[model samples]
Target: MTDTATPLISLTWTDHITGRRGHLVVDRLVRGVASGGLRMREGCTLDEVAGLARGMTMKEALHYTPGARYIPLGGAKGGIDCDPRAPEAYGVLVRYLQAMRPYIAHFWTTGEDLGLTQGLVDKAAAEAGLTSSIQAVYPLLDDEEAARRRLADAFAVEVDGIGLGELAGGCGVAEAVLAALDRARRPYQDTRVALQGLGTMGGATARFLTRAGLRVVAVADAKGTVANADGLDVEALLAARDAFGTVDRAALRADDVELPGDAWLSTDAEVLVPAAISYCIDSVNQERITARWVVEAANMPVRPEAEALLTARGITVLPDVVVNSGTNAWWWWTLFGDIGADADEALGHIRRSMRTLIDLMLARAEADGTTPRAAAHALVADRLPEIAARYGWYR
Candidate 1:
């Protein structure tokens, strides 16, 4: 099915400075605008960006709230093929954004994704001659200036040293796990989690889950797996990290044992989070997972065949479309006045919305004897038509 769905528009560009390629796929548009994020990484491909664009479509539709100010927009995604660590990466990024300026001006509102940071996106967008990365959605706002200010203020707020914008997605992920465990009657203290990638999403997830009384037995970074039979000090590890999300070995406690990069999959834990790169878990590596649940904090972390295998093994897999929709939803919620710039209020809203969405997805999964991803697609199937009927497919 994925091989054949035609998008509304697809674009590709070759960076003039570095010759790296970039892509944009507007999977669908609502009210003349679509929303998604831009990711930069080596080996990025048009097909990968296309798949992510479709995922954004499902993500937007899944958050449809009737009578709410924050109506979900259509889905889109952009990606650049270049190592974000390279010296010429920023120049390539500027040229890519400049090439995508028209879309950013009128159709696609975006910010950071994998291998890129929010601040980096903002700076590059500015250099690309755009006032804001999300300017495309400005016309939809009742008060554009007020909305922009609100969003900026939200980005400024911090909770326990983490920016609110960075915390939003992870907060949603942790709440999804908590809600799933609640349905299974599992105690938080007994649930041990081993996550891959201690980046923005992974780090914030560790912080939230740790506060919720769950034991984080292991965490994986670019370096390797940092494991302890007992929980590690999440805050100290979070503080000593560089911009690339690589946890410093100097910060490791005496009890912390470093393992191979792939060792996180086999760690003794009830829940496993793959918050890093895509296609990491395939049919082979999935056999190493003993976790009861695999919550995808990263987009498309688990391959289709691996997900099937995980299901066959009686391990629940929470899909990314529903699990990681929080950051995008939070953006619209604040911009549309459903919530304000306050960190506590933003976190509360995320927790409530994510829990509700997770509950609905799991309940439908139970009723249909299907996976959460399937159930989420079913929900999107139902919601998209309702949304389209209210505000036609294209404005």
Candidate 2:
């Protein structure tokens, strides 16, 4: 939430084969473990990973319950600077994981992030001589075998042909949207949404929001934007995506008008969800947005200045640390026996948790007379010190 303090560990790795750079930052640790994901994309940097690591810390703390077995771990993140679609991207990822094996075995528990999938990350981790990308957290499990199976079962269960793993975060995002809309006394049936990115997070969000009666009028992928004023066929578009989250043009409906990728930013809609890469929205493009609320589903998708501008315009910017946190939380909830592998149970838990969290955040923002981001920072600022006091900051 706030600026990242001095990290417990920071390392930059160079892939021996491709010389692609990778970075890992352990922003903080709780109870000997840190949790985050590994992402692969062009131009990923140490600073970005550091910021993401800090966000993870806040996210973990935000979910802290008065008494829960899944005590939140500290925050950490791993990044590899390479296109996941490139031929050698797999090799680069495996080597990067190999280089960080010690950390992965000790302090860092990671899965897939942007530009990577859980299946692919698992495969890469196997090749990297690791038990699992999240093996670092095994020491905390009460029954490692049952916990592993719970998470695995959750991943294997698919709703409407999309893995539950992919839907959890989007479900949280949708809940956040619904929460804001309900608070404003707005009807979901009349609301329209424009989303940037058709990747795991964005695509799943479209599915849930559509199911909830919101018209997903526009969606953007690497190719371009597809728009239909009368809601999109989220499932059809989802089926058209490749492993990299690019939708196939052949699947587009005739009436679905194609626009530039940036068009999603300016599309006429009540809500805009940026579920893609970081810093995609700057002060310049922030002007094009008329959406009443900007729900961040991606890590650091909106720049500080852009958020400031959006807030000045009376647009509620729901911070990512609160919005797209379900996927990470889902993992721990299952692993720590807080929830089972059942889809309904998982989603119900996420909805209740996100709605409660959003309500608390919005209330604090109101009480403090500040933007949601600053309020979230303030909340984290209070929780982090208490968590550290009890957990010893790091193992």
- Please report how far candidate 2 places residue 189 from its true position, in Å: 0.6
lDDT of 1: 0.93
lDDT of 2 at 248: 93
- TM-score of every model versus the real structure: 0.98, 0.98
lDDT of 2 by residue, 1-395 (tens): 43357988888999877889999999988999999999999999999999999999999999988588899999999999999889999889988988999999988999999999999999999999999999989989999999999899889998989999999999999999999999899999999999999889999899999999999999998988999998888999999999878899899888999999899999999999999999999999999999999999999999999999999999999999999999999999999999998999999999999999899899899999988888888888888777777777666
Worst 10 residues of 2 by lDDT: 1-10
* Root mean square deviation (Cα) for candidate 2: 1.1
For model 2, what is the error of residue 15's alpha carbon versus the real structure, in angstroms, after optimal superposition? Answer: 1.4
Tens digits of lDDT, candidate 1, 61-86: 98899888998998999999998999
**What residue runs in model 2 are displaced by over 4 Å at the alpha carbon?**
1-4
RMSD of each: 1.3, 1.1
Positional deviation of 221 in candidate 1, in angstroms?
0.9
